[model samples]
Each structure stands twice: as C-alpha cells, then as structure tokens.
Target: MKGFTSYAIKNLKSTGSIARSSKFLARNLAKQVPTDAKTIVELGAGDGIITRELLKYMPQQAHLTSYEISEELLALLQRIDHPRFSLKHSSAMDIVQDFAIDSVDCLVSCLPLALFPLEMKHELLTHIRSVLKPNGLFLQYQYWLSDKQLIKEYFPHLKTNWVPLNLPPSFVYTGTAPNSELVAE
Candidate 1:
C-alpha cells in the first residue's frame, strides 16, 4: 500500500490512520455491525482500506455508501467495483443533503476529528445526528483521546476501546445516535 502512504503524507491533515494495519480490522468492524444492517455509511474512506474490510464483513444484502472528499482517493475507491458499494464524492457534513434523513443504519468514520477545527467537527456531528436512524451506530477511530468529550456531546451513550496493534496505536470510539425522541423537543 505504497500509494496509501504517499496519499497519507500528502494529505496529512485529512488522513488519520498511518496505515490500515490488519490488526485493527477485526476489532474495528467485525462485531460492531448488526447482522441486519441494511444501509451503512463510511466517512473519510481513504483508498478504500476500511471500506473493503467493511464490505467483507457486511451482510450480502447490505449496501454501503462511502464518502471521500479527496478526488485522488475517490478515484481509487471507485475502481473497487463492488455491487453493494456506492462511492460519494462529498464531505461527511453533506450527508444530510445527499441522503434521506433517518435512512442510515450505521456510519463508520475514519475522520481525524482532533485535527479539525472545533466548529467543523461540531457541524459534521450535527449532520451525522440528523441523518442516522434512531440509535444508529457511529464507530470511529482516532490516534488520541482528546476528542472524547466532543464525541460525547453528539452521542451521549458512548464507550471507547484501545487497539494497540495499529501503528502508533489507536482508540476506537463506539457511540449510538440517541433515539430521536430523546433529542427532540
């Protein structure tokens, strides 16, 4: 995955993981996805590493839509040619406008939240909350725990786990979009 490293260096601010270390693959996705998930979304799907892993574990009938803002990565992702995959050239915040509300069952993100400006992170989470089905899952990994409080703001019921096998290690944050009525007036 030389191309992946090159892209990561060139887009350090946008790229989070040093590499898609195989060690985290099982822990990242295997047990998280519900067996019946119909519609899943992936944010910051760089070079489709996690995207491909997600596909391998997803139920055959489930469809996954991955969003990548970088055209360079999007080109590589589009070539995967999976029948259940849909690649979107957009930012995570655009999901609300790009898809129907309450339509997504799960969202796995590789976004570098700690590197983002506070407002952009907040705005993205707002849109994420809007598009997810009630109690939908948002699984994300970061190299640091600084964003723990930020994630808690958007997803109240949250837990974190550590995966040391990855380069530089990583923390996996699992959260659920609160049931819609709980957040509504």
Candidate 2:
C-alpha cells in the first residue's frame, strides 16, 4: 500500500499533504481572481502549480503571498525564488492572524475543505472574512458539493460556478462582502 501510494503521488504530482488539482480547475480559479488586485493570498499552495499560473495572470505590480503547510513544497518554492512571490511555511488557518486585518485584496484557496472538521472550517472562514478587504473576494475550489451550506452560512453573498473539465470535476465558490453580489447566472 505504501508503494502504491508513492506511485500515485509520483504520477499525480501530489505530496502527502496536498491534493492533485487539475489544470482546468486551476485556470478557472485564476479567472475568478482579479488581475488588478494589489495584494493576493493563496491558501494551500501545493507544489506551486497554481502559484505559477497566478504569477502569469496577476499584474506585474501586484504582490502574491502563498501559504503551504508542507515543508517540502515550501522549500521547493523558495528555490524558484520569484521576486513577486512570498511563501509562508504555515497552515492556511493562521493567515488572518499572521497578517494585518483588511490587508488582503483577495484570498484564493485550493484547500481540501471536506477533510477538515466543522469547527476548523468555521474558524478559518471567520478569519478569512476578518482579514479580507470589504470589496475583496474569497475563492475556494472543492471536489465535493456537500459543504455548500457551510460556505453559504459563512459567506452569505456567494457566487458558485462549476468547472467540469477538472479530473474529478470541481466547484468554485466565490464569496463577496455583505453589500456586494456577483452578477453570475
């Protein structure tokens, strides 16, 4: 079983701490992030796959900060050493407390939300809300739809889109502040 897991990890390009996300899903999530955003934060930045795409799409003047729980992936990112990118070797849940309140223009997460316990999810979402700018967006992609209610409860004004091109398909949930609403059908 260990050998099989290792084989799967090698082929899937996934570390034990991160999920293997499809390129299609990454593109869709990238589109949701505003290119003009000044300060962007990425949660669960595994292997820097989405990080590479974000740097490609984000404006040159923008600053991109990423958090990765895995020391291996964090070390790997440091080796690439992009000037516009800053990586934190920490858990996504600690982002709000680590950074100043309302300092982030956007929050993009590729976290495996379904794996987290309910209390942890709620706490993270609360922290995310506290740190985000009033007009900022919080984008999260998940493989399952079971957590839709949990998302809606935390982010009352939320917009959801499905990207079927992903390996296992995925849902992108974009959350906005109370007074804002996305014009998605």
Candidate 3:
C-alpha cells in the first residue's frame, strides 16, 4: 500500500489521487457496467484497482482494454492474468488510432481533466466522442466540478454522484453520448 501510494502521488495526472481509489468508489463506478456490454475501455487505469473491479462485472465473453500511461504501473496491471483483459501503453488522447468509430460500449476514465489545459481537454473530448457508440457510457471521477459544463458540450445527458468515501472525496460523472445529428440538423 505504501509503495502504491507513492507511485500514485508521483503520477498525479494519471492516477488522479494521492491514495488508490477505495473499493467503494470503484464499486460505484463499476456499478453502471452492464453485464451485457461487449467492450469496455479504461483510461489511466492506475495500478489496476478499478481494473480488477471492472473485471468482476464483465461477462466472460467481454473484452477489457486498459490504457495506462505510467510505465511503472503497467507492471502491476500486467499481473491481472484475466483471459479477456488486455493492457495498452498509451495515452487516451491517442485512442482514436487504435479504435474505429462507435467501437466502445463503455469508457471508464480516471484521467484528471481538472488539470488539463483547455485545448487538450477539447481534443481529448473530441477523441473520446469519436470512439464511443452512440449509446455508449462515459464514466469519469474527479475532485472538482469545474469541468462539468465543458463536458456537457459533448455529452448532453450528463449526470453525477458524489462519493465522500475517498481520501479527498470525488464526484463521479456518468454521461451518454451527444446526438451528432441534432447538431448537424
């Protein structure tokens, strides 16, 4: 636990917490992962804590693709040993390169959007919108509410839940994809 916390602090941008996420938070985030989902993707899957929690809800036939930018943490995630789990060493910003349009059923993101620059945030949201199915779910947890309006621009049906069990408390954002045709029309 000590070493993991050190790693998380060292990589705050990716891990987004001083301590690893509590199982309570993990459970709350994973709760929305329906058993019927075929593909689940995780961004900044720190130490695979949430990664493991996600697996418990995943159907055996489902595949989970996790992206972890911290090389040190990648070693921990590799120990997952699940037949359907795969790890990628890349940033979520480049997700479009690896996936086709409307490919992801759910994207569980641990990225710290609050710390991102405005332009980078826009780029990330655009890339995120590209990969999600029209009905796809986007789950994100943050310590601040500053970015809610920005996210609403892309995901019109955004809602939130607050989890005070974490070390610093957090807000979980659940959003449905925006209607592109609504904009086009």
Candidate 4:
C-alpha cells in the first residue's frame, strides 16, 4: 500500500488528537463530497492530504475553499497553486461568520469530531447547517463510530457508510438538508 513518508506520518502520529487519514480514507472521504458542488468548503485540511484528492475529482468549475489551523499545512497547500483552490489559514469557528448564511453548496471535513468538546461540536454543526444551501451536503469522516448519534441529532437525513480499506478503518457520514426552500427560508 502506498503510504505517507515516515517523517510525514510521524508528524501526524505525534499530533495525538488529530488523525492523519490514510490515502484510502482520504480518497473515500473525497468521494463523499459532491463532485458537482459549486462552492465547497473543507475544514481541517491537514497537510492538504484530502485537499489533493478533492481536487482530483472536483468539477473544473468548482471553487474549493479549505480551512486549516496549521500554518505549516497551509504553506504546503499554497504550493499546489490551483486556480480553483483557496487555502485559508484559520480555524473553522473563526470563519463561519465570513460567508453569508445559506450560501455554501457543500461542506466537507476531516476534523477529529471526537476530540472536540460536546458543546463546540454541536455549535459547529449548527453553524455549518446555517450556511449550507438547502440542498447542501455535509460530508465528514471519523476514525470511530461513537460520533454517529451526535451527527444524527443535527442532521436528521444522515446517511453513513464504512470504508475498511483504510488503515484502522473509517466511517463516512453524509448529511443532506431535506429541502432547498426550507433550508434557505
């Protein structure tokens, strides 16, 4: 299996809380983000691992905006230099106010939900839903299954699938807003 170099993997491993997803997991997560999404936002884009995969499959006209808290990682993404890609060196919570409500086409995340405080997790979901278009999709991957209930509570139309091909396995959860009018209104 192709894997990140030892040094790269080591950095991820040392993070303790942040899991550096395997390439398989990254590809699977990318697939969950709608390829046709006009304005896609990715949260916690560590090392641009999933960012690269998302770019590979995204529509040419799609605009991909990725937010990463790590300055080092943001620097790496800057080197990619794709016209369709924008890297933001900021935390997700810090930028939610920047976009208008109900304007996002899709939101994809590689953040470690389990590591977040319960209140923060809920607030993030609520904010994400508020900004997403009515028919918008929220795609997230986790290393464990415990967060399923939390996700379901916020996204009633949640759908989940497992990908065992990844190291230590992973689960992809997709939440679709029920109706465009209801979401935007």
- Each model's TM-score, in the order given? 0.91, 0.84, 0.93, 0.85
User: Candidate 1 overall Cα lDDT vs. reference?
Assistant: 0.81
Report the candidate with higher TM-score, 2 versus 4. 4
The top-ranked prediction according to TM-score is: 3
**Residue 41: error of model 2 in Å?**
0.4
Q: The CA-based lDDT of model 4 is what?
A: 0.76
lDDT of 1 by residue, 1-185 (tens): 35887778777777865565454754476468878889999888888778888888998779999999988888888888889999889888889988788888888988888898988888888888878888888888888899988888888888999888777788888889887543421
TM-score attained by model 4: 0.85
In Å, residue 11's CA in model 2 sits off its true spot by: 14
Model 3 weakest lDDT span, ten residues long: 176-185
Q: Worst ten-residue run, lDDT, model 4?
A: 1-10
Error of 1 at 113 (Å): 0.9
The numbered model that scores best in lDDT is 3
Off by over 4 Å in 1: 21-23, 181-185
Each candidate's lDDT (Cα)? 0.81, 0.75, 0.85, 0.76
Quick one: ranking by TM-score, best first?
3, 1, 4, 2
Per-residue accuracy of model 3 over 1-185 as CA lDDT, tens digit each: 34779977887765667898889889898888867788899998888889999998777678999998877888888889988898999888778998898998889998888888999888888888889888788998988899988888888789999999987799999998765732211
Q: What is the clash count for each candidate, in the order shown? A: 0, 0, 0, 0
Model 2 per-residue lDDT tens digits across residues 1-185: 23323433664433322335667777777777776688899998876778887887887688889998766566656765688888888888788677787778889987778877888888888788777877788899877787888888767777888988765678899987544432211
After superposition, which runs of candidate 2 have C-alpha atoms over 4 Å from their true positions? 1-19, 179-185
